[model samples]
Target chain A: MNNYALSISFIDNKLLLKFSGELSLYSITTLQKQLNTQNILKIKDIQIDLEEVCFIDTATAIFINNLLIKYEKLDIKVSVNLNSKDIKDTLELVKNQKLHSDKLPSPDKESFLYSVGKYIYIYYISLLSFLNFLGNLFTTKIYYLKSIKNIRFKEIAFEINESGVKALPIISLTSFLIGLVVAYQSSYQLKIYGANIFLVDMLGISILRELAPLITAIVIAGRSGSAFTAQIGAMKITEELDAMRTMGFDPYIFLVMPRILALMLVMPILIFVADMMGVLGGMLVASLDLQITPTLFIDRFNEVVAPKHFFIGILKGPFFAFLIATIGIYRGLMVKNDTQSIGFNTTKSVVESIFAVIICDAIFSIVFTNLGI
Target chain B: MDKVIEVKDVKTVFGTRVVHDGLNLCVNRGEIYGLLGPSGCGKTTLLREIVMLQEFHGGSIKILGDELNGISHSKAQKLRREWGVLFQAGALFSSLTIAQNIALPLVEYSDLSQKMINEIVEFKINLVGLKSADANLYPSQISGGMKKKSGLARALAMDPKLLFLDEPTSGLDPISARDFDSLILKLRDLLGLTIVMVSHDLQSIYDTLDRIAIIDNKKIAFEGTLDEVASAKSEFIQTFFSDLK
Candidate 1:
């Protein structure tokens, strides 16, 4: 039932008593009995090393404090050594609490309202800070561009080509399935009006202007965004960022710039490939269901999905890429010296990048719709 | 005994907590300077400031006679190339092999060919007393002492004039700690490099340091040779030294 365990090591008359386990209310009587049985009162100097101790409660602190006072009266010195700061601070707190035990507790009613108002103020400040960050991004972009040029472009090209090009097959296949589903669904509706051939136009426009970019963004966000966050986050937690700084290397240049630029370059190409695959998927469905010739479908697609649609879709590519890389790097840099912060930032990066991509897509949709493209 | 690093009236504050207040120190060339203090006494913070990893709010730091704050980024990087740091916990890249870790600085900073870089990595590895076969092993595959050695090898890859180590002997057995200390002494003697180490290991400090700086009460509480520090009249220092013994 004893909550505390103490082992004494005698080294040249120095009594080093190693205290371990918990020291709580349940253990105090047993502890006192053990101390008395060990003839602890006979010892001149007792070095109570709490380094190995796991837990110390109020009861333990009071017991230790009383022992110290008792030993003081006996003219025997008592010294305590605690390994952890938290434990030491907690013990100090226990001592202070004992000193002020007679004081009445007063709860402030306005504390809740104060906290709410403080949070609101923080929210506003954060919003303004985000705007400032956006403004800094433009200035940072200039520095980033200059620094990007310093990076081994060949290395970046290899990384991007590996990450982006290798992903093409999966992206193409997924987008193709999306196109096929759209074609099959629209065919059912179009056949009701006896205008089934128009399914080509519907599939073509949707794949080109919306589905391709949206799907591509999501895929890249999951793949590249996560990679960016994990890579930078690992570097950060490991002091590699500090290493870079000490080496006189701008981490933004050595790490972030290449990543951001690589994503920007690769995304547009990936989107283009996705668009082609999606259209081909639509063609497969159209020929199978509508009994339409491939030539007729191509003609309709070329007529319906104009250069404007292609341009707008491709435009979203770089923006989405930028969003993913920026959010990833920003979140990665935001990570503190802890593993939990890294996980939190990585999740934030993925969520923020995806959200930003969707919001950008909405804006593109509204703009293209208004422009009559 | 030329002054390689000088800090005058430096102050660093994170929010309301003053990490360093008016802390001053001067480290000479070719001397092993040890900063011995309890946890959160700003030893690491001071080391960070020396390498320009952390900024100061007041006063100035001069490394090799160049004002730390005034140096341009590229210039600072060049300055950093002259100094090597072995961070606490080794901090080796998980993905990189020992060879790749050692080769990083040479590859990044120098125009050495792959063959030359390989030779340099081998030489550095051997200098740290690790076999060339150990080069391919990742940091996780090695023991803690080996990792520390690998970190030391990586730091020395650039042939830096100054070496900074934070808790270099931490988390090692007595023999390993002693071996690491000997390796540090060997590197310093062989290369004639100045070393600034932050540590609380009394044995290591006494065994290796030419001088010691004691950080306490948000400032440099004491700075002198080990004998002077041991013989000092200060209650805190006396208690600290006695506790270590």
Candidate 2:
């Protein structure tokens, strides 16, 4: 199955090329090597033998067909000796395929302009659908004011537990480690000049105003965002979403709204917890490595970091939550009716949400900097 | 004279409901057999049980003279090679093209060359009255009738001795349903296959089935030739056949 070996036999001016084993992609290297050793010009005539070939995939069939065509071009009277009708029919089919399919979008005709246009059109369609989804979501939320019971509070509570409560362990762990690394690296230079107290200033502002919320958003995007897409994508595949719609239930309210609302409500709380853990990690590093006491670090932290800095960080939570939840829910609901689409959409949900969160963070930084927060 | 399928005292339960109990049926070789029942009457469950896709709670079911409930895995696989099933909605693999879907059985079970596989693929597709060009299209690209036809072609890939059809004429239009029934009759005549199909289409049942079995209240209410079923003296049979009016 792995190797397609070929041997050439010369008998009385007429050369016989014997094909042994499978002539497939895995064995293409050896097949090409064996096929090249024969001098078709000097032999005057050749017989292509297939008596020993055990099997051939599509790639091997195309290879053998092309080799036969090359021999035919050399004016060397070459005859095919396929012992089985099966092989002969396969060669015919592959030959037809090459002739018919080759005429489609040949590189000679369409390349640069065609690809650029195709991608632009695809992106335009996706962008339009995304805007449309946002419009529908806004309308649905507005209607929630008249009928509050339609919001599915139980499902929202469940999602809060899943996306918010369940993610605490990993989020806190990563944030703690990130805090320790930043503190250690910064204190490495700070301790040289006995500026250990400034480590408190640097770690306090960075962990609260930047690292904690950003890191928490990313972890939740990976964990809960992908989970939301996969869960809804599976429901879409098995026709559960359709069944719900038929039974007088809105998927946006019952499925998407709960997930979005849960993430929005719990994101600030999770980020707050992560901020505490991260500061604790930095404080632990300061006390052990730089000889800064627990009381001194806290006293320094309180003097430099204002309440507005912490508020600015948590303020980005609902925005980040909206971006992640919307993208994930949109990708899931819009997935095509195939299992491959589930994986494809899930990956997209995670990647796009992460990218959007970073951009949102940068914009928040610029706005907050200008406002002097 | 040859019995292809025998079901005796078979029991099927779904939660609190007993779908089938002590249901007995015998199908002969090379005959078109139809299973008729109302909605939620366990016709599909019985088909699944016979095909060994689902297990029964009790009793014996024999297919091709082998006890389906007691057969070993290897033996079941060997038996499976001799029969083909066309599920409801075709259940054609969505990813693969029609030709590849039909060629799957031969490619896995036989050592035939690619040329032979292609030939068999084209032949079965033609046997089911599909155009040669239809072979390259995926399941989603085709219409519902085409999907059912391609499903039929896939079922007949290995020249199975028995063919099972689950709601073969359900989703098709009236004209397409009639054509499909004719195609089934043609294939059965050509291949000499014993066909057991579950259908609610009266036209299809009357047109294709040589014999009919009616299941009611967890048992076979009647089992006989189509003509015998039409004339059977029973309350269920009277109401069931009266629907033909």
Candidate 3:
């Protein structure tokens, strides 16, 4: 509620201000602004009468104290006429606050150029640290290669279940929808030219060579990549990673390798599943929309869709897996001493992995086009 | 002479584990009351029950004349604003600066202008022994002690008649804990607050709490001032209070 009343007047070179009602932070601003627009400097004396004020909070109390100080600094006579001990005690609280406190140091503000320089510096440091992490991962993998028995097979199996097998439902749903929509849309044009049977050729080639692998990789990047970041980041925050290091366990070998190996091992299988589901969807749309029988669709698919296209799609899986796992684990290790940074790094991991997958796909397109695959 | 809070035969159960059965306690107005017990003895749980954050299996908790059980939504909200709670880990929102954290309750519940809110926030910051410059830092950016102080400032923002603190001095250094104890005493006398705190710190208990209730075996083992607690026969109570010379 706007529950305060304020009035001001001048009498014999003295500015008299009277306030009433509940004087709290809710109404102090209006009173301050009104007092600000007045010609109080011209008066020789100032009087603030809070006799009718029923309640006053710390904000109003501080305001009254400031008014007394501001006018008194001008060598102007100031008097406060209030009888409430509550108000008096609040003012005294402010007074004690001023006397017994060490002001905390605030952060320094930087110029635009300085901020740019700082950003570049931070980027450089992070790049160096990422290179270090990559080097350590390579060495750890090579060292564990000689003694393959040292690998954490249990953790890798668990991760495969988490990132690969558990992802089948969502992957199937999205891939099937995409394949059906593409077949339906392409059949619209193909039917106009009496090329209804060519729907199988289009769906088989595209889904096997590009759509299945790319879609599956993108989904994994969003799911497993983000989980890797958040899990590791939480471990880092709780000092679990540090505890492992202190106990003579290398985190890269123990934690990072299991995730990387599991994802790489599962990616190709996940893409194969996506290809089957997508083709199943396209086969349904082919029979329903184009009046092509299931046998006819299967015949066209097997005769025209080359094995090289399916192999090419599967070949991209491990590379995409490597990119997603490395980026995810790298971002996780980048987390600082806060829960917020874990969230920040998790978001960065997903975006970077997805972007990298697309870029890697573009590179594959260029290489295949040149080699005439 | 007025009772600010009363827990009558409160029973709390989780599965077959009975945390509190037929436990009772009362807090008088304008007194600093401590809820003390051994670790995992349900001191924090009892405090949570009183603040209405957790529900009890049976019995009623009355705060400022309103029964918590079967209370209406609007009535619960009104009762909520009448007091403030400080959690163990400070519980400041990581997304907001310290100033914004303290200003949140006032902005949400009052018609105070932004400028006035800032003034009140500044006063509260100072009142809790926090510096004005520390206002811009997020909860994660500040020290543990500073975070506790910020939490205390936020708790006092509405000038609540009752304050609930859970282990306010647990993680603080000795100097900061002592400072917190004196701050509690000063704020209690100045604000006339009836505080209910769960504390393991012996120094804080002796320095601030006018009365204490020690929970043992899911019931109130003893309830009185520190002088009266020494005579209690419970082994847990003797172990806890015997260290005090």
What are the per-model numbers of colliding residue pairs?
Answer: 1, 0, 0
User: Candidate 3 on A247-277: residue-level lDDT in tens?
Assistant: 2246787789999999999999999999999
Supply fnat for every model shown: 0.63, 0.00, 0.00
Model 1 quality (TM-score): 0.82
Instruction: Find the 10 residues in a row with the least total lDDT in model 1 chain A.
Output: A143-152
| Candidate 1 clash figure, as a count | 1
- Report chain A TM-scores, every model: 0.70, 0.74, 0.86
Question: Which candidate, 2 or 3, has the higher lDDT?
Answer: 3
Encode model 1's per-residue lDDT on B1-245: one tens digit a residue. Answer: 68999999999999899998899999999999999887888889899988888889999999998998777866786798998899887778777899998898888888999999999999999998899999999988999888888988888999999999999999989988998899899989999999999987878987899999989899988999998986888998888778878
Model 2, span A1-373: residue lDDT tens:
6656677888899888888777777888777877676556676788889878878777878888888788788877888787877777788899998888845564566589998998999999999999999998998788765587667788899999999999999999999999999999999999889998999888888988899889999999999899989888877775456433322245787788899999999999988998998998999999999999999989999999888878878988999999999999999987877999999999999999999999999999998889877
Give me the displacement of residue B100 in model 2, in angstroms: 38
Predicted candidate 3: what Cα RMSD to the true structure?
Answer: 21.5
Q: What is the DockQ of candidate 3?
A: 0.02
lDDT tens per residue, model 3, B104-217: 778766899999999999999999999999999988799989988988898898898999898999999999999999999999989999899999898899889999998888
Local distance difference test, each candidate: 0.85, 0.86, 0.88
Q: What is the lDDT of residue A139 in candidate 3?
A: 82
What TM-scores do the predictions have?
0.82, 0.51, 0.57
When superposed on Cα atoms, how far off is each prediction in RMSD? 9.5, 20.9, 21.5
Ranking by lDDT: 3, 2, 1
DockQ, in order, for the candidates?
Answer: 0.49, 0.02, 0.02
